[model samples]
Target: MSASIAARNIAGVVLLGLGLAVGSTGAPAVAATTVHTGVATQLGPCPTPTEAPGTEPIPFPLTSSVKPTDTSTSTVIVPDGPQMQCSTTAPTLYEDITYSSPTTGGVETDLKLDLQIPDTPGDKPLVIYITGGGFITADKSANLGQRTYVADQGYAVASIEYRTQLTGATYEDGLADVKSAVRYLRAHADEYGIDASQVAVWGQSAGGYLAAMAGATNGIKRFDIGENLNQSSSVQAVVDEFGASDLAGMADDYDAATQTAYMAPGSFINNYVFGPGSTRTVATDARANRAANPATYLRRGVSAPVVMLHGDQDQIVSPSQTLTYLNALKAKGVEGTRYVVQGANHGDMSFLGDPDAGLLWSTQKVMDVITGFLDQKIGS
Candidate 1:
């Protein structure tokens, strides 16, 4: 028996979880705690629609001869549907609240967020969720129902709207909008029952890129302009789900057809990101993308802990993007984790354990990966 090993378990796995540090072996830094029900598939906190036909195997002594009967005529059959009420503690939603009003794309529009605060009182960590729409339509409400999983974890989940190309927003403007949302939350923390000091950013695709940039550029004065000057726009954690990392090199990861499409003049990826319309040249466009890269700002201490998740089946932003981002993280000595969800596509909620949704991965597993990391980082 070794005395040094005696302090810890000798037979089980030993993990050195420093925030979101993925080991060199590339396993998930945080393994979710699974609760096994009697059924094989229901290893989550909530009950799924499946239960392998329950039966009382061991019969009790005949205290009373009982027989089941349908006593109520009110029982009615409904059409086939996949929705199941998982929790009674519904979050308090504050919808379409104006956070910032910036004139982007020549249109001065009020950017808003739909905040979901848990039913439990007291302060909780705020997760600023940024939606992805390829920078063409960054809607605040897309996949909003999927966000409830994050909110149900006793955290305030704010789905924010950032200005996109539709609003004539450049990558810089979009980043500013995301950061401004953070400052707004801090300035009005008391009203929302949020622990402003403990804040995180979670985004998908383009939103993911912005979220990563926000986390990587913490303490920098450039993007901290606009609302709530008194408060800092720094976030403690970041979750980049299938986001574009290195914009300049991203085209290289695409297939020949996609690369051609991406490089085509006036392409939305070109027009919205780098060069506008026919004005885009390869050199100038790549320069703009390089400027928007989070790696440009990532520093060891300045960047928040980040956990980048990607689906292996993602066709839009190739899975290699996560690796590219992770390489940048390693170069800066920043703490980062990489998690690839098998059978999961891009940011499509349709595949989240619903027959209509395609049932790629159980929603419980996804939320556990996301909220679990948030819990480790800034969870109250």
Candidate 2:
């Protein structure tokens, strides 16, 4: 079946399910699953600057500074596979590193992330990976091998879990989680021997949306939430793969008639932007929709360099999303690169290789492109 047809069928079924759910419960129900079982760490304030802003700089003699010692280790278990070729060595994996952030209700939620550090480490650059599931379901385990492969390449890789629509979380909540995770990692960079200034954020599908938001609003105050407020959540680079850059525009383009259908409230696209149980039109809330869009944050001096990968045949997020975002970046004089994978559908592994070769081959090919891009932008 063609990807577009498959996506439309899936959308119909999902809308039907949502309708039934609303009918039975009279409201959107939050999933009962508990996100975390432990108390979250409390981060302290940022250190005061030595000198006042706009003050004349003090002159000091240039001297050699000793680099911090490397004493960190990884615990990731490596399986023998073709993907192993991406990394020459195994990385130490630290699972379930928890960080706390507040939801719209101001209630604390414990967010978890998995960190994979290269066994052979200096002050390595870091990359935070966000998984794609249309903002409804996904976890740190979604792309374990790819993450480990990156870690093995002399970088620290972190896979994070953010609240989803099922948890009654909106796009804003998810974006906040991404920023908070960056802050948490920076706050403890010394413990892991990470070069905090060289951090990059990468994500796929829904995760890509969050990654784009993080990159565009690198220093924006509104998205900065949770602990470690003193720490800058700004990332130096971003890799967005098949993610939506503009929520309102994409929704209107995807299925304008269905987007306003009574059952469309249950659709993933609507729920992600408007929150669960929403009945308002996506275009109705222009300000909220614009705030959620990464394009809104793109400006001449405020955005980070971005590399975007999208499938021309993507059924969920159309290629126009990337084109529109790239155009905006260009207009603002922001640096960015876009690669449209031919004959590929939404999240299709075939874009990486021949369909007959299987996922392992395709994954390795994709990894090469990603690593090469990282090497140029942030230095792998």
Candidate 3:
């Protein structure tokens, strides 16, 4: 059979099997399936959940393993699940902690962050959450549920509000704010009972891009800006969900037809990176683009291990972006892993909106991968 026909048959079989499985359970099955672009292989078995450090039992639907079929293809599966939920204890919040930034007139327009520590005692690792809004719009509380859940998992979580293009902030300004947040956390670790050494940055979409950049360029002097220059802004690991790694390659990822169809006015690539006046200049400018790329900072010794999760069918940020970044990490011998959610789309809503069975199944898988990765790389 032709490649296209063969793929169709495989998809049919997988969907049929999923339907039957879901029908028995009376839960909606997520119509998500792994889409293969090249030669296909037998579907791999779902990974076994890895045990996390700490007394708590590891969460369900965990991604036990991640295997890349080639540079471009891979499969990720989560076992059936018990739904994930946040902790009952309210977080001890340190609201709107301001940090000085040169970009915003020093102290007059200082950037702010909201630190949320679980009520549970002891010094815990810190995870800074960055929200996604195409670098144009976002608030610190964008992903409250996930951040709260992570805090409940015994980590200090900080939901950060950074400058955006709308506020005259460039990518450089955003990175500076993120680094400043890290420094602030470390400086105040004692007060919050946080283990400053075991810090992690987690973000989705635009925030994912920042997290990746922060993790890749840890300890690099140029990206470190704002107050607390004496303290370090380094993180132990990164969790990037569908973040754009290489800005230059984003427009290039689409073909003539795709680009024509999707590249509308005020696109994230255009407004955020290039600024308001020019069209396509930022996308074409090698120097500016390189400065913004997470891949540009990657080297043998500078990077932290990364765990990335992206939907195979994501139209906003192509899956190839993650693949390319992963390849760069591998080339430098930096530890990194990726989970491509089959038939998944751009955001959490896509995963959460799946059929009842698919929602629980996918959620468990996502939590498992993230928690497992955190356990292995940064502990707890």
Candidate lDDT (C-alpha), each? 0.64, 0.63, 0.63
Residue 39 in model 2: shift from native, Å?
31
The sequence of per-residue lDDT tens digits that candidate 2 reaches over residues 15-63 is: 1110000011121121223332222223321112232212111111111
Cα lDDT of candidate 2 equals 0.63
Clash pairs detected, candidate 1: 105-167, 105-168, 350-357
> For candidate 1, lDDT tens digit of each residue in 1-380?
22211222112121111000000111111111331211222213432222211111111111111112121211112212343223556566677777877765456776777787877768989999887766666656555455666776788888887876655667778888888889888877887789989999988878788899999999998776576767888899999987887764455544454555555666555655653445673435666767778888888887998988776545456667777888789889988888776544454432222233223323555556677899999976
What stretches of model 3 exceed 4 Å from their correct place? Answer: 1-75, 78-80, 101-108, 251-266, 280-282, 350-362
Tens digits of per-residue lDDT, candidate 3, 256-320, equal 54343224334446556666555654445678778778887887767889988876544446667
**What's the TM for model 2?**
0.74
Candidate 2's displacement at residue 374, Å, is 1.2
- On lDDT, the candidate that comes out on top is 1
Question: RMSDs, each prediction?
Answer: 19.4, 17.1, 14.8
TM-score of 3: 0.74
Candidate 3 positional error at 230, Å: 0.9
Q: What TM-scores do the predictions have? A: 0.74, 0.74, 0.74
Candidate 2 minimal-lDDT segment of 10 residues: 16-25
Window of ten residues with lowest summed lDDT in model 1: 16-25
* Prediction 3 global C-alpha lDDT: 0.63
